[model samples]
Target: METLANLEAFMRSAEHGSFSEAARRLSLTPAAVSRNVAMLERNLGVRLFSRSTRRLTLTEAGETFRHSIGDKLEGLQAAIASVSADGGEPAGTLKVSLPPTFGLNYLMPLLPGFMERYPRIRPEWHFENRPVDLIIEGYDAAIGGGFDLSPGIVARTLAPAHLIAVASPAYMRHRVPPVDPTGLGDLDGIVMRYLRTGRIRHRTMRDAAGREVFAPLRESLVVNEPAAMLEAALLGLGVALLVVADVLSALDDGRLVRLVPRWYCDAGAISLYYPSRTLLPAKTRVFIDWVGDAFKARKLAERFAGSLS
Candidate 1:
């Protein structure tokens, strides 16, 4: 039988199309991954990949081997994980991807308690802006909104992703408050430009009564990051539409005031995304439950609602 390390290296290398990328996913060195793949090829007496300086391509035999072992490999890994979990404590690297601001402001706070509970499970977290391909990227889970519902992936919503208009008290002091979206025309707007599209995001407002209003904001200042936009608003630069989770503290402390209190923009939900599997790894299972419990205990769902903002 081939060593699990060699099989894993071969599979990951094939999936990523590069030893370096495979190494990144496996937390191994490029040379180690390459050597393992070479060993696997030698054992099977076949050329698996056609390697070039710039690119790596799979041979015909390699494609056949991958297809034959794909599901089996996954099953083996799951079985090993299950055995490890049942044998003793849950012990493995728990890799996750999270939005930078959301991770820092919300998830990071729960890390200490989690570590205290499960000391054997190591956490590797990547803070990024864009949604990650959880399986392809080798992440155990991802936390964010608006991730595509890829095959074999599932999402558990943590809170509603609602955007509410906010501005600094200093900026709002002399300005007449907007009764609705129409009045926002006079206020300088600190708006967000989608990084991918380079297009200005226009927010449509809805109230509890199911009334809709078109909010036309003057793009006096534009930014891509929510943190930057929040800072810009806090500096009294202009009014901004910010997520409720980010601005909750600011509003509570009087640093920022909500505009058009009755209206909010529905962006969807903040959720935890993970592989949809019959037998989930213990580490991932605990993490999902932990976050859900925290959200319930803190009443974050209620707090995150834009209407409440």
Candidate 2:
């Protein structure tokens, strides 16, 4: 019988397309994953992966094995979860990935309350500006922006996100405010580099009369970090297109002002992305519920309320 550890390694390697990626997900060295695969191959007397310099491909035998074992592994996982559910008070490590800016500005503040509410649940948090594969990375959940949930995962909207054009008071003093999104083309505007798709995105604005305007922007200064862009905007470098939650503090302090009020771009909903809840561990479920309730009670919901619609 194949060990559960080996089965998990094989599943992760197949999902991630590389041994190194699978190793990272499991918090093991690449050599360890290779050793596990080698042991499995030795036991079965058949090769699993077609080794190459650039890519890892599944061999015919490997594909057959995966098909035969996938359902069994899933069943075992379900069984384990069912048994674990009988024990009360979620006791396990819950891993969550989140966007750095949103995590810092919004989620971090509510964590203390969540911790207090669920003392037995320990959370491991990873914050990044790039997209992370939840299953491959062994994450219980991820909080993300503007993502279309892929198959085999569950997604819950946490808040609506509105994209607005903004500039520091000092920057606005030297330049005329853009009357609409299209007018931004004539001003010095900063464009943030979106890591998931490698696209530079901006909000298109319109006047109260519905006249179209573009925000003056160039793809230069392509920053992948939201905090860095916020800092640049605070220093009065140029106009920034940002989510309302990200710049809320600056706006309240009079450091930054919305370039065009009553006219903004809809960026879609910010949501929590996770694997299927059918077999989710108790700790993971508790964290998800806490996040949902916290967002409802926080100011983020109010900010997104009128704009997200």
Candidate 3:
């Protein structure tokens, strides 16, 4: 039988299309990955991969082997997960990936409470603006704002995030507030650039007839970080489009004012996502339940109060 280590190396190489990428995923050197593949090839007495200076190609036998081995590997993983599901206090490290601004503003603040409730489960967090590959990177869970659900992942909606347009009180005092989205065309504003794609995105408003329209706002500054953009807006640099949760404190303190009342962009549901499987660990399930309850209660209270106004 081929060793599990060698099999894993081969699978990683196949998935990533490069020995170096596989090694990086496994936290090993390229040479180590190469050696593992070589060992596997020697045991099987066949060339698994044809390597050249420019690329690595799978052999005919290798393609057949991969198709046969993949299901066994998945079955083995599921069996291990089944064994790990034997209930106890959550005692392992849970690696979570999250969007930077939302994590900092909302999730991170709640973590202290979670930690106090479950002391045995240590969380390793990676907060970034870019998209994360949960399976390839071995992440336990991720907090995602977009509705894009990748294959083989389970997603649970956490909250409906609000996207609002705001400007500092100082800026508002000097310039006339735009009565509509079209009026915003002449105003100075800050634009947010996606870190991964480097594309600029702004919120547009719909007219009373329910037609979507955008303004020709000039971007005085473009930034990748949401926090930095918020800070710039606070300093009276220009107007900013940001998640409502991120600027709640500023809004309450009268530092920032909503650009258009009762008119804002709708961001789809934010969700907690994880690998899809028949069974989940007891600890992960408990945490998910707690988070759902907490956010739901908060949202209900907000809705009731909004209706009263």
Candidate 4:
């Protein structure tokens, strides 16, 4: 009988197109994944991959094998996960990816309680601004917005990914507040340059009653990261378009206040992304549920809506 490890190694290698990438997702060394693939190929007595320095292309037989085995293997994994359920505590290293600001502001507070409840589960977190390839990068879960839904990943929303205009109390104290988004251009604007596209964005905002307006800012200061832009806004440099999750506590504490509060941009939804519902490990499942429960207890969804509707 073929061992589950060998089959899994082969399957992941096929999916990721590189032994190194498969190793990352499997939490194994590349040599181990290579050897496992070699063993599987030997057992089947056929060449499975056309390996090159830069690419691992599937052979005709390999493609056929994958077509025949893909769903079967997924079902088997689901069955195995189901069978492993016991009335015991879940234990493992939970690897997660999160946006830095939101992680520090929101999710970090939930950690102490999570750690106390599941002492055996160790947390490994990566805080970054870029969206990650969860399956390829080997995250148990990721929390953010604007991530591509790769073949096997799923997203559960936590709150609205809404952007609202905000500025320091000092900055707004001297300036007349805009009655509408169109009037925003008259204010000093701290804006962000998108890292991926290298462009400054102007949003078309919507009011609660469905009025739309093209909002433009003066661009008095420009920064590449949200954290920096937020700091600039706090320093009274200019008004900023910031994500609601990034500024919730600041807004609550009076460091920042909403500008043109009735109008906001709907970027997307803040979400928790995990590999598969069927393939969830105990640690991952608990973490997902924990986040969902916390969001409910905190009423973050309602607070994150900039339209306040």
- For model 1, give the 10-residue run with minimal summed lDDT: 70-79
Tens digits of lDDT, candidate 2, 71-92: 5776677667667767666776
Cα TM-score of candidate 2: 0.79
Candidate 1, after superposition: displacement of residue 171 in Å? 0.5
- In lDDT terms, which candidate is top? 1
- Descending-TM-score candidate ranking: 1, 4, 2, 3
Sort by lDDT, best first. Answer: 1, 4, 2, 3
Please give each candidate's TM-score. 0.96, 0.79, 0.77, 0.87
- Candidate 3 to truth, TM: 0.77
lDDT per residue for candidate 1 within 1-309, as digits (tens), equals 899999999899999899999998888999999999999999999999999998678999999999888778777888788888788877788999998888998999999999999999999999998889988889999999999999989999999999999999999889999999889989999998998899998989999988999899999999889989999999999999889999999999999999999999999999999988767888998999999999999999999999863
lDDT against true structure, model 3: 0.74
lDDT of 3 by residue, 1-309 (tens): 877779988988887778998886666799999999999999999999989876678899888899888657756655555576564565566778888877876677778889998888877889876556778776778887663467878888776555667889888887888876677766778888887677987666543345665755578989888889899999998877777767777888998988855455555656788877566654566677767777786673243121111
True-vs-predicted CA distance for residue 183, candidate 4, Å? 2.3
Better of 2 and 4 by TM-score: 4
List candidate 3 segments past 4 Å from native. 1-10, 17-62, 116-120, 195-198, 206-215, 281-287, 300-309
**Would you list the C-alpha lDDT of every candidate in the order shown?**
0.92, 0.76, 0.74, 0.89
